[model samples]
Structure formats: C-alpha cells, structure tokens
Target chain A: MPAGEICIIVPCYNEQENIKNVIDDIIDNTPSKEKWTVLVVNDCSIDSTGFEANSTGKADVLDLPCNLGIGGAVQAGLKYAARYNYDYAVKFDGDGQHLAKNIETFIQELKSDKADVVVGSRFCTKHNGFKSTFMRQVGIKYFQWLIKLLTGKTFTDSTSGFRAYNKKALKFMSKHYPAFDYPEPEEIILLNKNKFRIMEIPCEMRKRQGGVSCLSSNRAVYYMIKVSFAILMAAARKPEE
Target chain B: MSAIQIISITGSLFFILAIIQAIRLKRLKEAYALLWLITGFIFLVISCWQGAIDIIADLFGIVYAPAILFLFMLVSAIIVLFQYSIILSKQNDQIKNLTQELALLKNKAQGCSKDLPNKES
Candidate 1:
C-alpha cells in the first residue's frame, strides 16, 4: 500500500447521473486501510450533484457559489489539498470515464518517486477502451505535436484529464491552473517548462456515462487555435525557482 | 473665434468640468480620470487655437487636418480601453481566487461544526 494521505479530487459539473457511481467505484476499488479522501467539487451544478455526493457520506463535497468551470473547480480541489496538507492528489473526471482501479497505479507511481506527476493515457497501451471520436483524436494529435514542438516533450494523450500529482506539483498547479479552455495541453507545457517530472501510464477509459462534452464539434477549430496559443504562451513563461 | 470654435470650446469645457465633477464626487478614481481630463484639455486647446490641428497634421504629413484629430481620438480611445481591459483581467483573477477561497472556507466551517458534539444529546 502506498503511504501518506492521498486526495482524489473529483471536479463535477452537472454529473448528477454518474457522480454517485463514480464516487462509489473509487471507494470500492481503492484500499480501505490507507488514508485517502475523495473530494467532490461541485461547480455550481444545476443538478443535485452536491446533494448526491453528500448523501453518500463517504466523500467531502465543496459547493462552489458560482460556476467556475473545470479549471476553477479542479484548482479549488488542489487548493483544498494544499491547505489541508495532503501528500498526494489525483484528478479524476466525475463523468465516469476514468477507471478507479488506475487510482492505485497513480499512487504507486508517485510512491516510487520517479515522477512528480502521472498522467493516465488511454493510447499508451494496446488495451481496448473508448478511444473518443475521430475529430477529437485528431485534435489531441495536433496538440501532442504542438507540445512536442514547444516543449520538446511527447505526450500520447495530451488532453487526458486523469492525472495524479505529488505535494509539490499539486501546490504549484493549484495557483497557476488556467480556465476551462483546453487547459490540459497547456498544463503539460507548463509542467515541462517548470522542470517537473511528468510520467504517462497506460490506462483504460470508458465513454462518459452522462452529460454532453464541454468541447463541441462546432468549437473544435476555436478550441485548437485557443489551446495552441495558450501552449505557446506557457512555453514562453518564466519558471519559478 | 468662429461660431464652430465657440461650440467646440463649450463642448470641451463641459467635458472637462464633467470629469472634474466626477472626480470630486468620487465617482471616478483620479488615476483613471486623468486621461479624460487630459483629453478634454487637449480638445479645448485645439478648439481655441484653431490652427493647432493644422500644425499637428502638417507635422505628421497628413493631407487632411480633421482626419488627424480623428486618428488622435481613435488612438487615445484604444489606449484607454486597453488599460481598462488589463484592470478587468486582474479583477477577474481576483474574483476567481475569492470564490475558490470562499468555497473552501465554507467547507471547513461546516466540517468544524459537524465535529462538535450535540449539546442536547
């Protein structure tokens, strides 16, 4: 078992249909003896996501006053972890796409101390999983190439939401996290530029259980352009000592 | 002065006075009001002198003197608007931080209250 307190930060925006099941899956899969807390950040969901998570009686729920989008919600979770002094924090999507079994794998990777952050990549292995739409896959590929060009680092799943971070990484990330506009690829550039060790592990993912994706087909061009500019800016940013 | 100069001078004076009054009433911060005050003063000078715009346009090799004034106003507007955008972006970040902090603090408070043993029990 991995030692030290771990926080599973689940940022949910109107995931009422799958939030409970996602939280339950995490609780059921992870070890019972180890110190781990599941934090559900409800980003002012119109649905009863907050109430459902609270009723579970097994997760800590933070009800944001207004919608801060995914970036703000995830940052809030990391801020909570940093304030409470947690050893590790893992970002798990609340739409039930991420697997709970991989949470242990992330903790184990962090324990080995080789990497400061671990990204769960679906394309890292040959395992059969929900590979996303063709258009999105093309977008992800473009981002992967762009990141490589800017940071000289190759990430198979550049936009993977399933990620884990240690104390140092989590504290640093909470402060600089960007808004909901394709922040994952930009984050890779940020982490790489800052000299943080980022590792990617193969993990299987399912299709999102409920709710529509924030990124729509119409906005794909805008998303790509915006995210590319953001990645370039992140690359040019000065690293904190 | 021509009739048009009289009208222009009156407008500039009114603009300057309005900015001053807003500053006096604390409706506008002095730092931000300074630009408007300076622009109004420039307008008053150009209107009163009449030849000042012609001189400026000639210096810039502009064929049309009135076009120079329009260009000047456009540039000033852009600069002022750009500065406001910067301030707005900063305020936006601050608001985001505050919201996150409020949520976290509320959660902590609830946890603390829940931990307290029931007095009635």
Candidate 2:
C-alpha cells in the first residue's frame, strides 16, 4: 500500500515443487522487493513443501503442527502481519497460479485509498486468464447474485484468493475471522457487516503449476451449496456488535 | 426380588465400575466423570428401590415412573453436551491464538538466522 512494510502471505499445502517458483516470481515482479517480504504458511503439508519453501532462503516458512485449512493458515499470516506492524498484507497462492506482477497494481489501488481491500478479479472486465470449469462458473454466478441480493454489492469472482488488505482489514481479520466453513464466502458477509470497503480489479491468473485444485472434481457441488447457504444465513444473522 | 430389579441393579453397578476404571486410567477427567457418577448412582438407587422413583414421578405428575428417569437422563445428557461444546469453543479460540503466536515466533527466528554474520565469508 504505502511505502511501509508489506507482507505477502502464501498459504500452501503439498506444493513443494511450486513454492520456490512462487518466491522467485514475487521477488522478480514486486515493484519494491525491499519493502515486501514473503511469508509461507505451510498448512501442515505432508510433503516437503515446508523444506522447499525454507530452502529458498527468500521466504519465511511457518510450519503448523496440524492442518488448519486454508482460512486458518491465512489468518495466521494476518496475525503475523499485525504483530510485525505491517502496513499492508496480500494473500498470494503458492501453487504458482497468481502472478506477482499484479502486486504493483494492488499497491497502487491501496496507496490511492480506492478501497480497504483490493481483490484480483478475473472477471472485473474480461476473463483473460484461466477460467474455472463451467460448473464452477455457474457456482461463481450463484455467489455473485447472492451477494448482490444480500449486501447490494456486485462481485464477479467471489472465490479469488489473490487479494490485498490495508492495515485496518488486516488487523481486524488477524483476530476475528469467519471461523466456520467457507472462509472466502463468509468473509464477504463479515466485511460488509463490518463496513469494510472491498473492490476488485481485472487481473490474469495462470493454471496451477503443481497441485490440483481442491474443488477440482466432485466437491464443486458441495462447495456451491455450502457457500450459498452460508451467505444466506449470514444475511439473516444480526451483525456482531 | 424380581429378575428386573436384580438385572437393573447389576447393570448400573457395572456401569459405575466402568466409569471408575476410565477415570483411573485417565481416559476421562474427574470434572466430566462427576456427572456420570451421579447418573450411575441415580440408576442404582432407582433400580434397587423402584418406589423412590415412583414417588418422585408422582410429585411431578408423571404417570410412568421409568419415563421420568429417561426424561431426566435426556435433559442431563443435553446439558453435558452443551458444556462440552462450550469447552470446545474455548479450545478452538486458544488453538487459533497459539497458531498465530507460533507463526510470529517462526518469523522472528528466521529473521535472526538471516541476521547472523557468515563465518565462512
């Protein structure tokens, strides 16, 4: 965001082959590599993901003893950002899908105070990158419509993890995040309820270079139903004071 | 007495023995075992002296005495489960806090390692 410290969090599981590539890409593409540091939350990977990330000597690796899933791992990273007094935090996937070149663009938006959170969207204008399967596209449309109906905010890619958070959002999420299922979907509701401004811009994403998507095969239906129900339930519940 | 009374008394007695064994083995905490101990005692008393429950049930306008026993059991089980749920929620919060702390500690440790002067240079 500003000229202050920024932490790029990479929450990965079983992604040993791609973690080094991710670190190199970030260092090569970040506008100011000196201002940014990479923090890899290893999410209790069963493989050598932690060792690979650590051996890179470019990113710090946090190896969790138990698998806390993607949301829990990312929250741990946020807490790290807050503890280190980082001015901004960005969530970058470790599967080599997210482009590090977009870091500058996200920083520009945050510096300009465009929004409290800047999300890298594949559908902000045109889907120029790797679009999900047709079924996933349908699921994305479902979330987009549901979010608009509930919070009156429109979103194209509701599940994109490539996002940047200002200090306020980072600090708040470091402690209080959606602890239940569907972290990304429930996050939209939580942010809206807490009055955090979220904006998305068009960005390109490559297909995973290593591991498979968690929602690759048959879990898509379950994810869609779970997130849809979670969004509706969040709308019904009163915002926590 | 009757075979039903004898069976119920022996069954409750065996349950009490099993619970004590579990507590002794450290499989169950004393705080949690207290409820089961009370439940076992209630069962032993009612099964031995069926009339006690009959009188208690009469006071509560419960026609069927054994039905009152089941109701009490159901209510107690729900309360116990709710207590465990509360404990679980607190543990979950603690786990999240510990995770955050561990990550921060690791980051600091890494920083220290990098800051160390190279000996081979």
Candidate 3:
C-alpha cells in the first residue's frame, strides 16, 4: 500500500479523556503495515478534545468552527477524505466503544471488493453480544425494521457508527450524508438509493471508557421519531443518480 | 368582515412581515427560510380571498381546504431537501477537482527538485 491509501476518521465532541488512548490504539493496531493516516474531526468541543487530538501526533485534526452534531462531523470527515483522494476511509467513534482491532476486518473486506461500504455489526458474530439498555435494543430493532422497509435490505445494526467506505462510497456520502442525531439509518437508505454496495462485518463493542452515554431515554425516543420521519421524507424524494 | 376575511388579512400581514424580515436579514439564500416565506405568502393570498381559493379548489375537486394545505407543506419540504442535495453534489465535485489539481502540482514540483544537482557538492 502506498502512502495515504487508507484514512481513519475519528469524530470527537468533548471526548478529551479518551481521544489520546483511542488514537494510540489505532496507531498500534492498524494492520497491513501500510501507510495510513488518521483524521480527528473536532466538532467544536468545549473541552480539550481538539487540543488532545492534535497533541497525540498520530492524526491530523480538522476543527469545526461550530458543533454540527455527529452527522455533520462524520460528513466533514468523509468530505475531507474524498477531497484528498484517499482510497479508503473509516469512521471510528471518539468515545471508545469501537475497537481498533476490528478495523482490519473492515479494510480487508473493502480490499476484497465485497462492498463499497462495510459496517461493523455487533450482531453479525457471536464474539461479543451488544451490551446496552433494553430500551436501546427496542429502538435498534425498530430502526432495523424501518431500514429494511425503506431500503429493501435487512441490516442487523442500522445505527452502527463503525463503518468503512471505499473512495466511491465516500464520495457519495460526502455529498448526501444526513445532518441530525443518529443519522446512520438514513445514510444507509441514501447510499442504497445511490446504488452503492453495502455489507456488514462482525465486531465487538465495549462501553465507553469515560464520560456518560450521550443517548438518554428521552433523547432516544426523540431520536426515534425524528429519524423515522427523516427517513420517510428521504424515501419520498427522488433518488440521486 | 367575516371570519374568513379577518384570517386572510392577518395571514397577508404576517406573510409580508416574514418576507421583509428575511430580506433584511439576508436569509433569502437559505432554502428553508424561502420555503417559509412562500408558504406564508400562499396562505395570505388564499385567506384574503376565500372565494377565489374555493373556486380553484373546486376546479381540482379538492373538498377540504386544509388537506390541500397539508399536501403543499409536504411537497415544499421535499423540494427544499432535493435542492440541498443538488447544492451538495456540486460542491463535492468542485472540491474533488481542486484536490486532484493540487496533487498534480505537488508531483511536478517534487520531480523538478529531484532532477536538480546538489549545490553542496
């Protein structure tokens, strides 16, 4: 692999405590021994996330002027990768739920040309069962059903943020990515409509190392309603060629 | 002086106020704000002259006026989203082209430096 073949994008918002550890893990665990770059997109964090990410020296940091939510942060990362001609780009959470060890599987799947976008699914393999509140499980199931209905494809984890994209997928997503909370489901539909291939790879998820889970019960309910309506609206619109 | 007339007049006034505010604030470029403006104006006109709106609705054979309003709102939302997507696509293309050009220039510069002889010698 030549220099800059693969780029890992980590979107951080006030995850100052875990950002350094996450980047260190990625630097240590990246496979292929190939030249890969990490891009830490700081979404206007009030904490030291931006400063810490820059201090680590393991990744390049792009600090957004204003907080644009997770969707906007991830989209900014994809746009950066796409603009720079990166062969592949992966989105890793800054809160540390995503394991760096599993990233190799995603890259290998992309290299095999199996899919343009490979999602890391906790449900795909029995290695580790997803540990979350029962309410979250219910919400996930509902979103999965909605994704299948809207996109005509069954996705085990529609809301997983650990995903990899080839150049083509990155290009498409950089343009039409959603701009709200829990945007993965709507993004899947948008990708499907654009005729990009998508696949799921099994991976384990851990609880956040520090800080609280951003999704409260109230927020989860609101997310469910908002995302459902957004997906319905997106489906009604014409698909982009 | 009927209820419909009062509603129409009020809607019209609100519509004008929104337009003037949008123009003053320079928010006309935002599609969401533009949609609101258009919706407001449509309501204003329709309310001010219910007879004309009824005639138009009858021509379309739409019995309930509120149903038509709901349909218009849905359509407006879809259009705004579609327009946003188009703008995003164009921006993506421009950025890609610019990056490619920069990469090419960097390669040329590297080649030129490599061909030069060592001045230290």
Candidate 4:
C-alpha cells in the first residue's frame, strides 16, 4: 500500500501571537518523507491571524466570513479535507497548547490499523505538563465520567482537542459533526454512537501562549449544560449511514 | 351581539387581513401562509357562531368552554413554532455549508494564483 496524504488542520481565532510558531513546529517535526501539508483555518479572527498564516508560505489559510466557533472551524477543515480527498486528517490546536512532536504517535496509531480515530490524552500518563486549571480539570473529569456512563468506555481526557482521524472517520464527521458551540466531548459520543473505533495515546500539552480561552470560568456552567445536552442528543440520534 | 363577540370578530378579521397583506408583500411564503390563513378562518367561524365553542367543548367533554379555545391556541402556537425551528435548523446548516465551501474555493483559487509566478519564472 502507498503512503497516504495527511492534512494537519490548525484552527485559529485571534492567535496572532502563536500561529507562526505552531505552524513552524508542525512543519519542522513532520517526517521528511511523509506527504504532509498544514492547513490553517482562520475562524474570522479580528486580529491579523489570517495574514500571519498566509505570510508563513508553508500552509494554506482559509478565512471564514463569520466567526464559526471552534466546532465550526474544525468542521470547515474536515469539509476541505473531504473535498480534497485527503487520506488522513489531524486536528492540532493553534493556541500553542498541542505539541507537534506528538503527531507522529497519532500517525503511527493510524498506520497500525487498530483505530479509526486517535485522541491524544494528557491524563493517560503521569506527565508533568501544563494540565489545565483546577476548575477546568473538574469539568473535564465530569465529561470523562459522562462519556464512561454513556458509552461504557473510559476516556481520561474527554476534552482534549488533539486528535487524528482516518479517511473513513473524517468523512462521516465532516457532514454529521455538531456545528454548534464546543464539539469536543459531543464528537466523542458521536463517533462512539457510529461505532468508530477510538484509541487514546498519551501526549504532552502546554498552556495557551496568547488569546483568552473561549470557555471562561463564568461560562463554565453554561458550557457543561450545553455540552451534556448535546452529548445526550447525539446518543439518542440515529446514526446517519 | 355581545361585546366579546364584536371584539372577537374584529380581531379575527384583522388577523386574516394581515395574513393576506403579508402574502401580497411577499413577506410570507404562500406555503407557510396557508397554516395561518386556516387558523384565521377557524377563529372567524368561532367568533361568528357564539355557540361554536360551547358545542365543540361539549363534544370534547370539556367543562369550561373558553378553556377549549385557549387550548386550541396553545396547540397551534406550538405547532407553528416547531415548524419554524425546523426551517431555522435547515437554513443554518445551509449557511454553514456555503461559508465553508466559499472559504475552500477561495483557498484553491489562491493556490492557483501562487503557482502562476513560479510558472512564469
């Protein structure tokens, strides 16, 4: 079998301070022989994120007309991956949190033919990295328990944005993934409902280098309720063939 | 006629006229307008025949006659609102698809334009 084409989708919103380093890290760490291309999806940032990404000359930049939130931005990248017929797609956050070195593990897991989707879990191993704030950790644990209750599978990091998908997984998600607000936890339930094999590997993550997180402490309660309802809705929804 | 009857008839007439006027101005699509037009016609019938609510409520074994009308209005509002939510969801999906497609096509165009300089060189 031939080596497959891979598209690393970096969804950014006002990450002008960190987009360049993120893109460069991805480019530098990518295997030399692998056919890899970085695609920076600028989610209608008010800053010069789009311009910064364009000047990098190493990745393609897609400027959305309006702010589509993280879910919509990632979905846009998946749609592009589907349109271009990429064999694999990886979602790497542009906030300087996710490390590029871990992408190799995702690719290896995909090549191993064990899982259709690979999620990078920070809590899977005892690593001394910048785990999110205490409040966020509590919220993450809540989702972790919720997913376990719903899917009968344990996920240490239910809200980790670092993930990779094969063509089969990406195609289904491109069309059916929730386009509303945050989709990380809901998407895990969606994939499980559709019988997609999901595997998690340990990966290190850093704190955000710039820009405010969309989920502030004040919005945490709302985020939990919205995402929990969405997860339940996804569980009850019939799988689209 | 009772004062309530006169008020009901006037209200129903205005409602029906507003529906027609909306259709004329192309603000309401005929398909959706049909539901509201039917509702207005029912209201006019009930208003004109003072005993209509009494008879219908009796048939349904409802003790209070006016409560039946309120129930009818509530059910109608719910159905109309539910239909609107469905339409809103479909349009939202379309808008999202269009936005993504536009961005992807523009990226492709930029890629082609970037290659032109290399080709010339």
**Candidate 4 residues A15-76, lDDT tens each?**
99999999989988988767777889999999999999999887778899888889889999
lDDT of 4 by residue, B28-78 (tens): 999888878888999999999979899999999999999988998998888
Best model per lDDT: 4
List the lowest-lDDT window of 10 residues for candidate 3 chain A: A1-10
Predicted model with the maximum TM-score: 1
- Candidate 4: where is the Cα deviation over 4 Å? A1-4, B57-64, B115-121
TM-score of 2: 0.83
- For candidate 4, the docking band is acceptable
lDDT by residue (tens digit), candidate 1, A151-181: 7788999899999999999999988887555
Candidate 1 reaches a DockQ of 0.38
iRMSD per model?
9.1, 8.1, 11.7, 7.5
Model 3 chain B lowest lDDT segment of ten: B112-121
Clashes of each: 0, 0, 1, 0
Query: What TM-score would chain B of candidate 3 score versus the native chain B?
Result: 0.61
The candidates, ranked best first by DockQ, are 1, 4, 2, 3
lDDT of candidate 4 at residue A93, scale 0 to 100: 97
lDDT of 1 at A106: 94
lDDT of 2 by residue, A1-241 (tens): 1123788999998998899999899888877544767889998899999999888777777787777778888898888788778889999998999999999889788879988888888888764967577877877888888899888889887788898999999998887776544578778787888888998988999988978666656777678778788778877887666
